[model samples]
Target: MIKLPKILKYPNFSRLYYAGLTSELGSFVTETALMLLVFKLSEGDKSKLGIIRASFLFFLTMGSLLGGPIGEKFNRRNVLIFANIIRIPIITVLFFSKDFYSILLVNAMVAFFTGIYNPSRQAMINDIVPQKEISIANSLFGSTMAILHMVGPFIGALVFSKMQGIDEILTFDLITYFLGIALISTINYRPPKKESVDNVQTSLFYDLKEGLRYAQKREDLRALLFNCSIAGFCIGVLIPLLLPFVTEVLHLSDREYGLMLSVFGLGGFFGGIISHRLTSKHRPGKLIVSSIAFEPLLMLLWLLIPVFIPNLIIFFFWGVIVFIRIPSQLNYVSETVETEYLSRIHSILDLSFVVPNISGGIIIAFIGNSFTTMEMLFCTAILFVILIFFKMFTSSSKALFKSEAKRVTRDQSIQDGIA
Candidate 1:
């Protein structure tokens, strides 16, 4: 038998890690294929692509409104399984979709279940991993995602380039989804003793309110939520804009664009390894704020440089900074939240990002083909500035960035708890 890593030695988390890894890769590949399908079905309307993406975000947000309650009310593992199982039929329908709206609607439905899956899985991480290993666990997850984002698109593009029909990609997605469920079934999870099963609230609305209230009560969480939203908005805006920016302004080919993504992923994987080492010495909050402060500047620098080689360098460096920041952020949240409130707070955090992500897509979609590529590029540039300035300057942001800076890592916190 293969010897597991220290953190993966936890039986439940180990299964969850593999299950989530495969599921995430499947999602990325399918997402790439689905986008191509929608673009083709819509007869190459670029705006519709943005619309499809935005609709997914909107519906995902809607689903998350209830995911928190359900996760808190039901067994979390069951919720994760249900999230995957429910999507099989929906994805099956995508293979038959002929119209743009049908494609959009089906994918958006997948997003709803995914919205639930995201938070429950996030919340569950703290439960299964040993506190000292939280940083490494999160690094593994983030690194895998970065790798998928790097490669999944290319695989999807290649598969679709050879497409006999949409069914092939959707069929693959369903198989992976089923595999995710099966892996989840083999893993065993035990909720902490304090999380009484009988204590579930009858009212999901009230349960949600309680979560919102919990965030409002804390200075740091409120700040973190704000940061999550802005970061999401940056992502949202970039999604619709980046391709155009590369092709039109930078005069790079699709191949170069793919290369940029791959390099970034490669850098992120290394950065995650570095971060795994850093957690032993530094606080997660400090890692996060440092990443946040440097990112927009790096983005600004990349935009200014504009050469293909330098842009690749910037993308790679940015990815490294990002992967470093993510694990630290995850470690921070894991150490901070109480057991009972963890799932709900995570859901609220998901909404924090997803809602703004929707808005960003809508903004780009609304811009339409009316503006020249330069004008949209100009608009995107403005977003970068705002993203930079806000994170660096805001007062509550200062408190938020510093909030966990003085605190100990999860390992230390766990030690303190035992004492």
Candidate 2:
């Protein structure tokens, strides 16, 4: 078991975590308020709101697709700082936009920059953190994000309800973004040395092909990515339907819906804490499978609870299980990949979700949300079950566990060589 070190003891990591928390909280506040503002402007029309939300996802996907090559080409920390600086004006524009199209444009821009920001930030962590502690670090990161989700929306709701308009929320978000920029700028870490100039001079197609080839050649990583893409697709189905289910089927109000999201965040927060502690004690594959198995059961239970209970007790439990899956999965991905390619690999994995999310939205639009959710959940559950069985029969699970061991051994050998 690899005992994890406390992040508080690492000054740089502590600053990074605090900055991420503040920025994430601000983002949640801004997003929630923006959704409300769009609703108000559209006269209770949901389609426009959906379009606004979907545009952000679309641009984010574009940004991530571009982010990999840029991060590899430039200093990732500088890119991150630059991304933060660029957001201020975009967010400010959003604050005063007179029409829905203007607001959508600004939000889309913000999403694009945020997409660029994420891969760089992830790469920075890889540069700063030790290999052994990557899981714990990622867990802490996930926890902070979950905490922001838990508190940020409620704060946004309260501020929105008390204030006259969305401007205040946008202002708050802008302030946090600047604050994050300031904090990130203060960090003094150097970027990892790149491959030689000869390596750098390769055509863009070659660079991308290399990344793709690396992914295809790594057997364990290939399996992990396959499962991750499937799980992401399932999650895409679940996310859009959750609020609707709470409102339409459970007869909940907006406040109740917010509360349900908060519960989910709380669950994620605790899951992050648990994962930080448990990563050293168990195989990540085992943890991932357990988390994946729990998700469908919880979703099914969420659907069934309405039959017996008057209130949303099962919703809270479902939130816990659902949130738990995120950090565990992230840690697994981080641990599976080498540090040099971590950012690009993570971006590729993220794209798996982005494609599914966009496709899921379209499918929902065509088939209706309820049917889409049911179909996705059932299919995902059955798929994971089959994978688990195949893994057991073919000894793939043992191979995955051994892969981690080999990674650690290789790291030790490198360190010993340097010594």
Candidate 3:
């Protein structure tokens, strides 16, 4: 077994972790509150909710596109700080918005900053942690996100229910952003100076083109991105369906539904722990492919089995297996790709995940009554299974996997030699 280094021992990583924790915790509350606010403002009109969400998502995708260049071309820490600072007032104004359109405008602005924030924050992780320790860093970060997802909604709901207004919660979220900025500003990181030969000036579009070319040249990286994109789409489709399945299909109460999410979070927490230990032991290519393949099978099983206890168990592992591979995926990128392209690749990957997310609503709307939700789930799961198998066995994928295994071996040998 490969031993993992302690991530918290690094002061900068610790600060980033705490900042992320606070930020995500606040996000959970903010997201829940925003949804409630939208529902209230629209008088329970579901179509309006969709419009609001789509507006935010549209700008978020745009933000991510711009984030790549902004993150790579500037000081990442300052970029992150600016991102947070910009969000504070935007969210603050959300509380005072008189109409849904005003709220939508604010949401768009916040999301644009978010696109900038996420890539810069990710780049910061790649910057502060050494390649060997990147997996641990990502593991810790991924775990925090999982934990937030588990209880953040419940907490957000609770606050919204009790306070009877979005203002307090919005203020709280603003404070967390403030805290994130403060904590992040304290990290002692000096950005690396740009290195170039022949002094060629490159436009942002040029950088984006070059990044795409770089990803295209590496079979392994392309395979990883393609597989992740498919998996992300599946996740997007399934996520919104979970609540409906729990409430309607299982006939479970809200409290029970919350517990189920908590259990999933617990599974993710443990998975993060397990991932830290296994990250060094496994080959990245195999780990990523196997985990991606495993999830759809679980989703299919979820549709087949209707019993609550069995479904609960499945959800637990669903969280575990899915979260476990994320750190490994990020670690693979960190180790295999050169540092110069980290921000660009991260932004590209981020866009891949978000772009598919919008399709989930379409999937839900399309299959709403044609088949039962569970049946739809089964069909989607099967679709993912077919896609994964086909992709894995394809000529390009096979070559990618083979070359990736060799690269992992070479990288490990170098790390061991250094140790």
Candidate 4:
């Protein structure tokens, strides 16, 4: 029910939002098809699937690290447009390749471009929306992604079922990327005079170092990064394990599993709507903390729930908590950092997720195929507790909220005076 505010009524932001939606929906299709193709080609070996998934994450991390400098050195919109344009060739190659290694290589390339695209796109959004409206804007964006996740796969499935070819799905994804690029190309992005080239360091290594150093020196950012890293590590364990758990332990079919994922996406959509409304009136830090605190507990309860029911209600709650928390964290990062440094900030923050994603898979793999569901749940709980306790000790939420409010108010007052 939450509506986008007047601040987001600008045509540029609207174009960006639509572009994001189209691209995300395309990603959903590509991801679903890729996973299916991998499983089929590998004879249902979960390890291969994990490798495919991990490779994409690895490339994404590399891209994130590289993107920071590029974002600062060039116009962000140009970078985004270039990345999207590059995707056409990459995806075109994917349409022909069915080999495991080739598919993995192509997928990694796609993810690499995505990494470049994401930070620049996000930085652009930060530039477009008002300081106070950042959180709500992010929530709306999250909502769009959630809805796409919910519907995109179903549409993919329908298309794939009819066409019965990876080429068809790849073509669909490629077209969406082109659509996104066209939409983004129409936007007018004027970098603020204050954020011009003189303000940004020219050296890539020095710029990268500055970004890392800035994150380290900023109290709220440092805490946010640490807490989010722990959270990502925990979630990384759950993500690959979910489908297996549902199929192997709960004995759910592919169709049923897909439905469960859709339900989770729906939960995310609802959560995003709620977050969009609340962020305009309340501090994002509080909402983030509450959501993070609740996720582990709900996940733990989900583990305890008897698997008798055909539908998994607990998964819905888990999805809701996770989705709600994301926008709050994103809002904090996007709003607190300077526009010129926004991409670097995002890259650094994303490292929290990337490191864990790559390492978590290997750790889980080594822990053996025999690791029980309950054991995994316990590990997740422990990590969650550690993160929550650290946040409490640092009182990060309170500090960030107060500081952000003061910064925004000051910016607004200055703008008003100038106006």
What TM-score, over all chains together, does every model reach? Answer: 0.89, 0.84, 0.87, 0.88
List lDDT for all candidates, in order: 0.75, 0.66, 0.74, 0.73
Q: Which regions in candidate 3 have their CA more than 4 angstroms from the true location?
A: 1-5, 36-54, 98-103, 163-165, 362-376, 399-419
2 against 3, candidate with superior lDDT: 3
Query: Model 4 residue 306 lDDT?
Result: 37
Q: Write one digit per residue (lDDT tens) for candidate 2, span 244-347.
A: 55555666545665666676677677777777677778767667655655655565555545542432455555555545556666666666666656677777
lDDT of 1 by residue, 1-419 (tens): 98656666666787788888888878877877666666556654557767877999998998888888777777788999999999989888866665777787887999999988887888777766667667778988878877877787667766776773467777778888989999999866765444455865468888789899988987777777777787777778776666566667788644564567777877788778878788788767667777777767776787778788898899889888888877877877777777677778888988998899898888768875677655655566577668657666766566666654333333222221110
- Residue pairs whose backbone atoms clash in candidate 1: none
Clashes of each: 0, 0, 0, 0
RMSD of each: 3.8, 4.8, 4.5, 3.7
Model 3, residue 344: distance off in Å is: 0.4
Q: In model 3, which range of ten residues has the least summed lDDT?
A: 409-418
Judging by lDDT against the true structure, name the best candidate.
1
Q: Which structure among the candidates has the greatest TM-score?
A: 1
Which window of 10 residues has the lowest lDDT sum in candidate 2? 410-419
Q: In angstroms, how far off is 130's CA in candidate 4?
A: 3.0
Predictions ranked by lDDT, top down? 1, 3, 4, 2
Error of 4 at 376 (Å): 4.1
